[model samples]
Target: MAWLADAVVALVALLHVYILVLEMFLWDRPAGLRAFGQSLDAARASKVLAANQGLYNGFLAAGLLWGLWLGPAGFGVKVFFLACVAVAGLYGAATAARKILFVQTVPAAIGLALLFGARA
Candidate 1:
């Protein structure tokens, strides 16, 4: 069960890194623009804002990694980060995109449950 929790945390961390890349470096590019449903020009105009959002994603990734490295001490950290992810996803689903609910929040919620329920 601990291993499962750890694997889920690791997966979430990796996904965050990918999100960071998409928001920070590729927001104005084809993939990012397509994902966000924005034209290149619009995406370019919002590049700075997207970069800032991406930095937050990077921070989440860092926290998850730190938690992973800390073993059992990581439990709280993982839960916190996953909670953040869930909130962000819910917000995005409400205002930005519904896909965020399934893609981001659901996985994080599952990971959070596993982590919180894992045997010590």
Candidate 2:
């Protein structure tokens, strides 16, 4: 169970890292355009904003990795970062895209469950 939880956390971290790359490096490219359903002009115009958002995603990934690196001693850190991800996912789902709920929130939720359940 602990391993499963850790795996989920790692997956979430990787996802955030991918998001960071898309937003920061590809915001004005074909890949970013398709990912965000933006036109070339729109992507170009919003490149700066996307980069800022990407930086935040990078921070999230870093936090998750930090937690994972701490091993069993990092339970609190893991929970905290997972909660942050879950909350951010919920907000994104509410304001930007509902798909974020499944992509982000659901995975965090699953990880949370495994973390707590494993302790039992």
Candidate 3:
């Protein structure tokens, strides 16, 4: 159970890192445009904003990784970072796209549940 929880947490972190890449390095490129459903002009116009968002995602990933590095004592850190991801996802779903709930929030929720359940 612990191993499974750890894997889920790592998966969530990797997803965030991927998001960071998409938003930061690829926002103005075809792949990012396609992913975000943005026109080239719109993507170009918002490149800086997307990069800022990407940096936030990177911070989330870093937090998750830091929690992982702390081993058994990292429960509170994991919960906090996972909650942040869940809230961000919820906000994005409301304002940007509903799929954000499933993409970002669901995974974090699952990871959270697994993390908690593993302690039982």
Q: How many residue pairs clash in all the candidates, one count each?
A: 0, 0, 0
Clashing pairs in 3: none
TM-score per candidate, chains pooled: 0.95, 0.97, 0.98
Q: Evaluate model 3: give its lDDT.
A: 0.93
Off by over 4 Å in 2: none
Q: What lDDT does each candidate get?
A: 0.92, 0.93, 0.93
Local lDDT at 16 for model 3? 96
Q: How do the residues 1-120 of candidate 3 rate in per-residue lDDT, one tens digit apiece?
A: 988887888888999999999999999898898889999999999999999999999999999999899997988888899999999999999999999999999999998999999998
Instruction: Give lDDT tens digits, candidate 2, residues 1-120.
Output: 899999999999999999999999999888998888899999888889999999998998999899899999878888998999999999999999999999999999998999998878
lDDT of 1 by residue, 17-89 (tens): 9999999999998889888899988898899999999999999989999999999987888889999999999
Best by lDDT: 3
The window of 10 residues in a row where model 3 has the poorest summed lDDT is: 2-11
Candidates in descending lDDT order: 3, 2, 1
Candidate 2 C-alpha error for residue 26, in Å: 0.5
Q: Which candidate, 2 or 3, would have the higher lDDT against the true structure?
A: 3
- Judge candidate 3 at residue 33 and give its lDDT: 89
Worst 10 residues of 1 by lDDT: 111-120
Candidate achieving higher TM-score, 1 or 2: 2
